[model samples]
Target: MKITCVGGGPAGLYFALLAKQRDPRRDIVVVERNRPDDTFGFGVVFSDATLDNLADADRPSYGAIRASLAHWDELHTHFGGRVLVSRGHGFSGLSRQRLLAILQDRARELGVVLRFEEEVSDPGEALATSDLVVAADGVNSRIRERLADRFEPRIDVRPNRFVWLGTTFPFDAFTFYFEESRHGLFRVHAYRYQPDRSTFIVECREDTFRRAGLDRAGEDETVAYFEELFADKLRGHRLLKNRSVWRSFPTVHNERWSAGNVVLLGDAAHTAHFSIGSGTKLALEDAIALVDCLGAHAGVPEALAAYEAERKPKVLALQRAAQVSLLWFENTERYMALHPLEFTFSLLTRSLRVTHEGLKARDPAFVREIDAHVASKAEAQSGVRVVSADAAPPPPMFTPFRLRSLVLENRVVVSPMCQYSAEDGRIDDWHLVHLGSRALGGAGLVITEMTDVSAAGRITPGCAGLYRQDHAAAWRRVVDFVHARSRARIGVQLAHAGRKGATKRMWEGMDRPLERGAWPLLSASAIPYLPESQVPRAMDRADMDQVTSDFVQAARRADEAGFDLIELHCAHGYLLSSFISPLTNRRTDEHGGPIENRMRYPLEVFDAVRAVWPADKPMSVRISATDWAPGGLTTDDLVALCGMLREHGADIIHVSAGQTDPSSKPEHGRLFQTPLSELVRLEAKVPTIAVGNIQSYADVNSIIAAGRADLCALARAHLYDPYWTRHAAAEQGFAMEWPDPYRSVERYTLRMR
Candidate 1:
């Protein structure tokens, strides 16, 4: 087989070498636009894990690269008049020039043709001649662009501006510096790649760049400014430049990796942000995977298909992480207000790939110190010290949290989960066991499932309610038991189903209409919840007044039941949520059009409920921060909504996302919705409870310590294990008490795994 690789970068050169080595009879030629020694970046960094793949793919190049690599295990963070060191993270770096030289030599030795300083203005010529053509060109690939009609590329140019340069300062560890300037905040990503040199990168917001006068400055002025800004860490070392210009990082993504006999590799296919240091590593790995797939498959189409099918998922995952890290750096100014240690921790875990436990595994001592810092601040604020000076501080999840008169024992909350076993909107034994066990299991607060304000408002026949005076008695029994038997505070989430009403139970079929006895639903507009479902009547003044009355009555009943707090369920495509989301709400009256008008009805209900509820008791409003559809509510909308809720006497905001429309497309991952909560808490200046996909005590601790949310609500974790808090406490060796009756079994249960 004859192969032509375009752009003699890592991907092209490495693929040429590997394919030739795998089959000595095969012929390979690499085309390049620059000399072997000419490279744009100063250095390339990789995790120690990448070396194993390199060794397995080709030992000679691996040995050559490893011989010149600079390895480090510690990360030094310089910020806020202090330097924090975290150990046990292994990384290796090498000069980009040296890496290219090694790959070029290896390919030549394997009988692969190397043609440098030759630009291929047209990649089609090679595709017409070679059996398979590899588009290994870098991020600005002409080949990918020429075939853009088939490739379907999407490029996202980020906001922050950054420039790459080199320095003679021999840094011994991976280091980052955050410095405050008169203009704004600036950051440095620097690390040693050789004995006498390091890669230095400067990044700041676009506004900050303009403020610092670097946007219009020449290369020399730009380098001089960064040298002076970070002079303290540089220790008088000078900055180096080679075509260094400030620009935004464009994240490139292609819908298809292959077109006909031509295929894209490395940056030609996708580009992860440089903040995660995966550009070189992913480029190299792509070469290895592409070569293996070609060797395993006979047909070019089959090989390219197998390669993309295997590699896209991994690349997309890393890109997602890289995007998170990029956003963190872009928003560095917002987090600089935190305590120094907390700020450092937030930076380390910004990608969401790292967790509290993951950091603990890397450096237990550093994590412990962070915990101590968080515990000290938590203790100072709550005025309840649980640990002595010599004792290990309690995990952030076990720290106390307060909202108005409700003082929670810890920050863990049992999220309201629907249990379709209620009869006529009244609680039964199933509700008791479902909630009581979690309360006994040692949560700080256990929130009851979506309790409807009226019988017609219930989602299913089995949904719990706070509508009737007798219904309050049923819930009162459960609330009384939780208060008497454990330290857990119980709250109720009162909701009205709106257009989504009269649905079958979730187990039967979510959002399916009931076979019989379906009730008429009311909504902000006369829209159906689903294409085949019931069309709800658009709510008029009378319907709005009745709903407001229903909510007020529910709050009164909740007070009578002696609940610790109340959460107004204004999220998840319910009545109030429908009014807030543009996708669902369409009216010509005062409660429509702009976001302010859209939020009017929800605010009116909140005001009425606040008047009827006690002054000392806290009420929270759950809101869908984003509709996950075009022209819908977003985190920006939440800022104004949260401010309005706060003005109406809401003590906290429960942040959730999506579910406002059935066609909504949500990006799901670990703690996916927590960013929404973080935005609400920071931008909106309100306390928020983060819900959705939060699992494990470490997640809770990280969320609280990072100030992303005031409290964390875990739904599936609580359902999977009623004693999740106790188990977390036991795992951390914290002495969390169990009820006296269950104390005997606690010892054995805690040890059960």
Candidate 2:
């Protein structure tokens, strides 16, 4: 078999050597566009985990790489004129030139032919006779460009500008220096790779680069400027340049990694941001995966598919982490206002991979210090003494949260879950038991399911409603029982299903039209929920007035029922959400077209409801932060909408996503909606309730402590375990209230100490 590899970087050389080692007669050749001794960049860093993989792949190469590495276990952050050091983060760095040389020597020893300084302008012509073509080229691969139509690459050039250079600083640990400048905030990511030299990367926002005149300056001048800026850490060491020029980091992604005989590897297929230091690690792992897949499968196409299937998800996860790290650097200015300890903690956990528990394991004393600091601040603000200096404080999830006149006992919220157990828009036994059980289970806030504003607005005949006095009276029974029996505050979600209404029960094919009776629906536009479903009437001025009046009546009813909060359900392709999303709202009137006009009716409805609702009681608006489809609402749009809602009178934003259209494809994962919540909370400067798949106590603790959201709502978790909050308290060793009747059971279980 003849295999031709393009680009003689680490990926190409490593794959060629591994393939040759697997079978000596494979006939592999590696082509390079640079001299064997020449390479760009200073050093490449790797985790101990990656070294284990290298050893498993080939012991000799792993030994060589390990021998050349400079190991460090500390991360130092120099900010606010104080250097904060975090310990137990293990990392190893090796010179890039040494790594390439090691791989080149191994490839030659394995009898794999190596070609250097021979650029193949057309990769297709160079590998025309080979049975398999490996495009292990760098980010600007000519092979990938030659087959651009087939590859379908998407390159996102990030906003921040960075330059990679080297210095003889001999830093003992991985260091990050943040210095405020007349231009802007400048940062350095520097770590020693050898005894005498270290890799120093200077980065700043684009405006900062231009303000500092580095955009017009030559490479030497740019280096000189950063040298003076970070001179304190450099200790008079001079900066060295090897083709160092400021450039925006391009994150490259490909729809497909392989086409017929040609397969992409490493940077040719994807490029992770350098902030995570996974570019070399990922490249080497790709080589290992490809060789292993080839060994496992007999056919080339099968091997390529298997390799892609095995490596893409892992690479994408790292790319996501890298993207998070990159964004943190880009927006460091926002976090600069935080206390130094908190700022360092935020930087450490920016990728979302690290958790409070993980950090605690790494440095228990540091975590305790943070907890004590937070406890002191909380005590000062609320005048509620908590956690004496001798004892550690409870997790952030257990801390009280105050909104307007309501002060929650904790941050845990029982998210509204649809029961679909109502009759003629009246609640029954199921509503009382379902909501009452969660309140008794010790959640700070308990929110009811999507209660329709009117009978015609119901998603199904079984949906709860608060449009009638009878409905209000029925809910009053449940609310009064919860208030009298537990310390939990109850909230009502008032909604109008709009285009999504008049459907069968969720168990009997949700969104399907009823077989016997279906009511007429009203929406922002006359669009059918499904192809065969009923087409809703485009709401005229009269229809809009009636709907708005229905919501106001519901709010009045909710207030009469003694609800603590009312969340306007403007999400999930419902009536108000339809008006917010362009995918659902298609009209030529003043109520449609541009976003401002589209938001007009929703704003009017909110204003009407707010005018009647008690000012002391907080109001929230649940919105689909993104439609998860093209030509739909985006995060930026949601930010603007949230700001408008805040101005009108929204106390909190319930952050949710998708379901705006049947074609919407949401990216689902654990705590997937939290990022949207974070964006809305920080960008719009409004308190946010993060919902969607937040199931664990650790998730709640991390999110609340990071200031990502003021509250976290759990939906399915509550359905499965009504005592989720109580059990979480037990897990965290924190005290929580349980029903007096269940005290004996709690004692038997030894949950309360």
Candidate 3:
């Protein structure tokens, strides 16, 4: 079989070499628009794990690349007049020109033809001759453009301006230098790739670049300005340029990686942001996957399909992380107010792939320092005296947090999870054990499940409620038990199920209507939660008034029952949430249409509740940051909604997503919802409690220390272990008080250990 690869970049060259190595009998030729010696970028970086993968694929080229690699284990963050160094993050870098030379030599040695200075405007000639045609061109692929209809490509041009340059700094570590100028913040991603040369990349927001006159400046002037700005760290090193010009990164994505006999590879197929330093790595990895797939599959079409199926998901994951890192740099101004230590931590975890435990595994001492600082700040704010100067400060999870007049002993919150064990909307002993144990277990706060505002509003017959006096009296017993036995604050989440109401218990069948005893539902529009479920009545003025009164009365009862905080349940297709999400709310009245109109009823209900709830106690609103479906709620909508909620006296926003519609495609992963909370906190300038997929003490510490969220609520973790926070404290070796009756158990357990 004959294979022709277009372009002589890393993707084309590496694929040509690997395919030849896989089958020495196969004929292969690589076409290049530039000479083999011509290259643009200075250096490319790779992790040690990537090096291992390369060595397994081919040893000779791997040995050659490894011999010339500049390796480092330390990451130096220079911010706020201080340099913080973290070690054990292994990385290697090599000159891009040298890498291409090695690949070119290896391909030639493997009997693959390399055509230099020959541009292929059309692949028709090669397609007619070769059995397989690979479009391994770089970002600007002529072949990909020619077949635009076949491979639908979407290119998103990012906002920040960056230039790739080299310097003779002789740096030994992966270094990041941040400097605040009058124009804005300028950042440098510098790392040594050779004995005397290092890759220096300068990035800034578009406005900052324009303000500094870089948009109109020539290469020499651009280099001079950056040199002068970061002169202190450059140490008189000279900056060199090889066609380095300011350009915004274009993130490329292709709908189909292959069309007919031609297959797209590397940047022509997809491009992750450079902030994550994954372009070259992804290209090489793609080469390996494609070659392996081709060797395993007998047909070219099957090989191409399998290659994309295996590689697209991995590339997209990294691209998502890279996008997060890109946004962090774009909004550097927002994090400038953080302390230097926290700023360093935030930078390390910007991609969200690096968690507190990930850093702890790399550098335990650095994580300890972060934990100490967080503990000290929390204590200082609460006016608590340290027991001893040398005593280890508590972990971030054990630190005190305040909201209005309530001071939580820690940052861990037991998220509201429905038990569906109530009787006639009245709390029972089950409530006392469920919520009371969690409060005793060491959480700073525990929120009850969706306590409905009215009997007709309940999701099921067993759902808890706050509408009746007996309900308030029953909740008081549980609240009193929590208050008497622990310092944890208790709160109630008042919700009305709306179109999703009258469903069976979760164990019985979630979202399924009860065989009997089902009640009529109400919503912002006459839409059914499911096709088989009842279609709810479109709420009129009277329905809105009655619901508003129900919420207000529930708030009064929640306060009477001694809840320290009140959270309005405006999420998960509930009554208030139905009025906010466009998917569920399609009313033509004043309470629907645009998002502003949809938010009207929810805000009115919030106002009514706030008017009755005690002023000293804080109130929060739980919102679905996104509906995770097309034409549904988006982050932009969430930001606007959060701002409005803040204006209407919400102390915090509980950031959640999905469950607004059944067809929503939510991306579930570890700490999936935290990014939504972080965006809300930064964009809306509102405090947020991140919920969903959060587990472990390290998660709480990382979220709070990085200021991603003011608090973290865990549902599954708390359900798995009511003493989750207590276990975390013990794991961190912090001394926390135990219940008087359980003191003996703690002592016995410690002695056994």
Candidate 4:
């Protein structure tokens, strides 16, 4: 089968190489609109992990990429009298021109044609000649546009404006500099593309552009703006400018990524924010996934379908993560004034796919010191537990933190995730095994996902509940077993769905409500989650009283079931969170407007739960932190909100951002949500849980060790490997035993042939 890859950039060339290498006579050709050595961006980055993927696919191309790489290991982040230098970032970047030269040369070696300066519209140029047309174009693709209805693409215009340009400032390594000027926060992403010249990508929020008259500035003026802002770093070298113009690339994430015989790859598929250096990696991974599916299946349609099914989920996950990261960065003004150090730390962690534990291993001592600072503020709050690293346990992240009366052995918590396998708020073996496995996997605490406080409060019918005595009895089975067997402490996330109620099962469609009928939903106002989501009933004073009582009753049932902790689901666009976020709450009553007024209902729910909950048992609140929607609750708002929670007795602030609105712009990347969590934990001086794309053990270790957040919640990673903590321990070359009952089995497996 002949495969024609349109738009010959890294994605197209790499896909051609992978496809041709997979089947030596498949006949793959890459079409390019630019000359062989001409390209758009200055320097593009690829990770060490990206190199490994290359080696696994095509050794020859891997060698070519390796030979051309600049091998940058160090990254220096600068801002506010603080210069943080980190290592093992593994960003091998070079001039885009040089990268294309390498790919073009290697393509020729492999008998693949590199058609340069040749443009094609849709499949008009290659359709008659080729069997498969792979659209590997950068952000904008004519082929994708023609088939836009099929792909159902969603192009998000990001709030920040950036310019991809080169400077001869000798920035010998990758650097992220946040400078404060008369124009506000200016962020520059600069890295060495060659021995002498560096690619300088300057970024500023749209507000700053208009405020500083930057949109009207020319090339020379832009350079001067960067120089003046980063005055401390842009010393003698004069910060030379290139001819590249300043513009913003809309971060594109599509609901559909592939069509019948055609598929989108790289930026044309999903665009990760520049804040995370995965743009090139994302393209290469798309190539890898396609090749794997092709090798596994025979027919073109079958392979493309399988590829889309598998690749779309993974890419969407990263794209979602990139959106969260981008949102955090674009909201700089809200955070800079509150927690600059935590802000910088959040940005640093968001750039990689490392786990919390994995980050701790990279720099344990540094992480420990940061944790110390958080403990120092115990006196700042009145009845809240002080999370001292040394006081908890010598293992740092492995130490169990206590809330109210309940004690969690470690900082890693299995974030409450939906199983969608329950029957009418009743859990089954799947829920038990899912929650139990993580408990056995070594999470200090495991919280069940949005266990509805009432039948009407469920986002979906499959959501677990604690409103009834039987439901409490059903959960007690899992809690009792976990308590009797695993060291993991069990916590429940009680919530009322409110405006988001009566949704279908997660697997069936996710957001759409049931077709047969609908349940009466209650909210602060009559507003709905979106235009499509069912419009909900506006809660009156009596409805509010009942909902608050429902939460209180749920807390009482949880106590009967022997739970160690109770975390209120006041985030993720649920009932409690709906009432708190301005983007959703539009009421004229006491539960509306100003931060204090909006938080009234949420705080009332907290008090009701706290009153019913045992004093010894710990209670926490999970907040979306940032709505990701513009003009929503900023971290500044969160700081004040957190202070209020502290006053009313919140032990830990469990933070997971976004889901504020479907249209909310999120700049997601690795650990993108951690920064906002870090700020609330640090500046507010409260124990906070960090989440969002926390996949690896290192990430878990680092956040705990760094004190960016006391607890790191793993959602998808735990799903992929229930025993991730155990596997990570072995992967990191540390020895730990499974529970005595499972020890024999673990040992046998470890020694098996």
Best by TM-score: 1
**Candidate 3 versus the native: TM-score?**
0.91
For residues 331-361, write the lDDT of model 2, one tens digit per residue.
Answer: 7887777678777877777777777777778
- Full-model lDDT for every candidate: 0.90, 0.88, 0.90, 0.78
Ranking by lDDT: 1, 3, 2, 4
What's the CA error at residue 594 for candidate 2, in Å? 4.7
Residue by residue across 1-753, what tens digits does model 1's lDDT show? Answer: 999999899989999999999999988999998988888879999898899899999999999999999999999998888899999999998999999999999999999999989989767788899998999998898889999999999999999999999999999999998888899888899999999999999899999999888878999999888888778778999999978999899999999999999899999998888778999899999999999999899999999999999999999999888888888888888787788898888888888788888889999999999888878877776677755787888888998877877889899999999997888898998898899999999999999999999998999998889899999999999999999999999999989999999999999999999989999999999999898899999999999999899999999999999998999999989999999998999898899988899999999999998898888889998989998888888656779999889877899999988898999999887888888888888887889999988877888888887788989999999989998999899888888887888778656743345
Clash counts per candidate, in order, are: 0, 0, 0, 41
Q: Which ten contiguous residues of candidate 3 have the minimum total lDDT?
A: 744-753
Q: Which pairs of residues have clashing backbones in candidate 1?
A: none
User: What are the per-residue Cα lDDT tens digits for candidate 3 across 102-126?
Assistant: 9999999999999999988657888
